[model samples]
Target: MTINVPGRFEVGTTVVRRHVWGGKVWSAMPYRVLEDVGDYLTVASWPGLRGLVSTTWIKAFLDDGHGRDQTIQELASGTWRLGWWAWQGTTVRSWYGLDAYFTVRQYFDADRRPLSWYVDFDLPKQRTRMGIDTFDLLLDLVAEPDLSRIQWKDVEEYEHGRRLGLIDDRAHQGVLAAREEVVGLIESRQGPFAHDWSPLPLEGWRTPVLPVDVRSGAVSSGLWIS
Candidate 1:
């Protein structure tokens, strides 16, 4: 599914992250499309954007005591209840590569100043009738807002997930390969790193709500990799 628009437009779509093992959805975040050309797609989410996620995430990350292992275990269990979540704090714009293992994100403050670059290490994205589908590997890489001085984030959780076999050999290898690809982008100033730090303008855009299928816990629509 190629998205070739004459220019950037606001898209009413969701980005769903499912577990690699059981096809259970971990999150289904709504996004406003910024740009869609060829194999790359850019989307934005602000404070009011609503989405669906596992209750485990709310307990583990939002509250306390649930820790990484329990989070991974319950997520892999594929039986957690889904709940609504809203984006808070800052504005986030995500850049997705149709066939790349990681997505690039830039954060903005209240004044719209760039904050930092967030690299989420995950399985490559697939286009679905409802939106995009992918798996989050529990690992991340962060860079300065200027897209420099990169560093690995969440190593402990990533390792723990591996130990628990949530990230199997194949997925682990994919993460390693993705690490190299992300580093190359930063080092060479390619991809999102090569662009201006300014975020895509989103004036007069309303926050998108989660898809009905996601809200109702129905199976995701058809998905296709580039």
Candidate 2:
């Protein structure tokens, strides 16, 4: 695949995610650029990085008995109760490609040791003025750091979303292909597994700032003022 490198975001530059769906911002996350070279862009987030999330989306995940019904309501209403999401887990380093169908993230424990690898299937990323635009396909794959074990996550959610028409046929097809790609990467020890997993020296870096108009639901341009 001839992937074109987009305009570079300098190392340590703050960028935001526009998790877009139906031309609306479903969610957003702020990350600091770690590396931007060739076809891959590496970004990192820590415990203090603020993010935007949808409360309605959260409800759909929590209400077991009515989860499917709630999801249907969410899709039809297209309503989002946006709120702040303080980053709480350990540090995360996500590797993305503008043309790739998925993102690979390495999770670190509280002491910064490697935890595991997470593969999130998503739409091909598009570079935006704020940062990047992509939507998750509701499916994910998780593997141990040594790649000795692997399992699929969110299979039930993915299938439910597909049945509810949240994931269209085209996107469904992309997710299928991405699943195979992720497996190949694991078996070959390619992609992120090919690089050193040493923790980056982030002693002096501050948490990235969230965009000011986080509640406005405006996606694409004008997210960051700086």
Candidate 3:
């Protein structure tokens, strides 16, 4: 579905509690909507992580629960400008595990649906390649394995070993269980996978703590709000 906004979406505030794979849970961090430019919306977070998230990333806008939106943009360079945001504060203290600048962009199909979203991770002086890295894990979750072995341990291991250490101590188990459940649904052909993950929120979006594992060796739980 497309976002039908009269103008830009009124930026709202929410707290995003991020849990890295093997790390601690950063809680009660605030994020405020800074700009909503039709197809895309930029939001600012405390401990400061600016998110140029697609309106499509929004599962729910206000605490009262509203609809969602999408993002679409292109620059002259082959480098299509998708969205931009800035994150503040030391990465060590806040939830997001890694300390760096984060930026996100999207490529769309003729119908305006996102073909793929790319993320860039900028560290202090040190720069890392930009792109999606979790594509493999997402494939594994959707393709072959049935839901029988869906355990948090595997995800935990993967997150800890592969990405920075961040995991919600309180909701870890539940999140793992929920992951398994979503996998089961996918294996049964009841849901969408990475290839077909459209409809805004992933089938597992509402499954608390299931955030995008950023390519920066850091996993963004996307569980925070301002």
Candidate 4:
């Protein structure tokens, strides 16, 4: 797969996800800039919501996943991982983030048909930026695809990390708000899980080119981010 090396993404243009905060970018996922939303820029990752949330729907429903079809969806600084005092491999291959009571995830088979949809319970995504860069707290939610299944992967370690002062708090409130909003989405099923959710990505369009930095251990890593 070939990664798009387009000139720096133009405002409102779609670009692959890089470590907006650090590490490496996921080449498979595509996101379009949606204007800087004061604290952070809002970019819509593709299949862009139309099939997921728009009236012009399809097999698409907005249950979140690694739209770029990457093996790892994220990475954090070494310090963040060290603070956790635990390891979930070194990178993210396929993962999503959630907090509060639960998080919703939509899965599909190779053919793009709905595989299973489920929720996970865990700590809310802690969003904080370092030097104008935003990143999530390094914690994870472990759950199965069974609709009613859920559990947190790391509670003590996360609390321990916080005690060690690894998590930044300036955006703690804001990140909680964000996490609440995610919960709202799962609760209401308003956007991607709407009754009309359809038009799922199929065949060649189901994924994007995997980025080199994360391609090495693609199947082994998964992340839960905010």
Candidate 3 structure quality by residue, lDDT tens digits, 118-184:
3322111111122111111111121222223322223433344223222333234434454564545
Rate residue 29 of model 1 by lDDT.
85
Higher-lDDT candidate among 1 and 2? Answer: 2
TM-score, ranked from best to worst: 2, 1, 4, 3
Evaluated at residue 135, the lDDT of candidate 1 is: 76
Per-model TM-score, in order, reads 0.85, 0.86, 0.24, 0.39
Cα lDDT tens digits, model 2, 44-123, are 98898778777765565457535645644564467766666777769999999767879999999889999999998877
Which is the leading candidate under TM-score? 2
lDDT of each: 0.72, 0.76, 0.28, 0.32
Q: Candidate 1 has which clashing residue pairs, if any?
A: none
Write candidate 4's Cα lDDT for 61-134 as tens digits.
13332221111121222222111011111111122331332334455443445445533332332232111111
Best by lDDT: 2
Q: What would you estimate as the lDDT of candidate 3?
A: 0.28
Tell me each candidate's RMSD, in Å, in order.
Answer: 3.9, 5.5, 18.2, 13.2
